[model samples]
Target: MDIKLDAAALEAFLRAEFPQVAGEYTVDRLTEDGLVLRMDVAERHLRPGGTVSGPAMFSLADVALYLAILSRIGPQALAVTTNCAIDFMRKPAAEGSMTAEARLLKLGRVLAVGDVLLRSDGQAAPVARASLTYSIPPAA
Candidate 1:
């Protein structure tokens, strides 16, 4: 499918529609299948062990899929996640950022399915993987 929103447009849409989280993530690039997203890890994103928190990783995966969907379907803010299954594979580094490679598996009239693999910045192996399904709001 043709891309409806590029990196710049997606970022702008995030800032305008979801200001609370707009600063937490950056759109690194968009590919033929999906996009790359970078999450700026901060102290607040860590748990007591000094590693990235599960919730933080989940948020990265969630937003990555959300943006991936929006890139193809335009800024449909109402589109929401219907299901998510995540696996935390390894520990993430305490410092730097995390990158989520999100790819759309399926896009249909009412549902979109995607997968996300997250890795700590500069790391080789994925720290976590997630499969998500989103419910797309019917066009008005």
Candidate 2:
């Protein structure tokens, strides 16, 4: 399917719908099949041992896949995550930003499945990987 939302539109949607996280995440790149997103790392995103926290990385992955689906399906604010499986692969730099690359594996009438690869800014290796399923609200 063709993209229904670009990077700017996704950013605006996030700012409007999720103001709390608007400043932390950025829609960096939107491709035909996926998108790249970045999350600014801060004190709140770090854990003991000076690494990015798992929850923070998971959030990035979730949002990335959510936006990836929306990019193709248009703005579906009610789309909800039905399932998520994440693997914490490596320690992310405590002070670096985190970037997620998400690709849709499948997009159906009611469900969208995607995977996200997250890495610390400037890192070549991924720090986490996540697969998610979102239940899209039925069209009115």
Instruction: Summarize candidate 1's per-residue lDDT along 1-140 as a digit string, tens digits.
Output: 88999999999999999999999999999988889999988999999979999999999999999999999999899999999999999999989999999999999989999999999988999999999999999999
lDDT of 2 by residue, 65-140 (tens): 9999999989999999999999988878887688999999999999999899998977899988999999999998
C-alpha TM-score for every candidate: 0.98, 0.96
* Ten contiguous residues minimizing lDDT sum, candidate 1: 31-40
Question: Where is the poorest 10-residue window by lDDT in model 2?
Answer: 89-98
User: Given candidate 2, what's the lDDT at residue 136?
Assistant: 96
Off by over 4 Å in 1: none
How much RMSD separates candidate 1 from the native structure? 0.6
Candidate 1 C-alpha error for residue 64, in Å? 0.3
Instruction: Output the number of the lDDT-best candidate.
Output: 1
lDDT of each: 0.95, 0.91
In model 2, pairs of residues that clash are none
- C-alpha positional error of residue 51 in candidate 1 after TM-score superposition, expressed in Å: 0.6
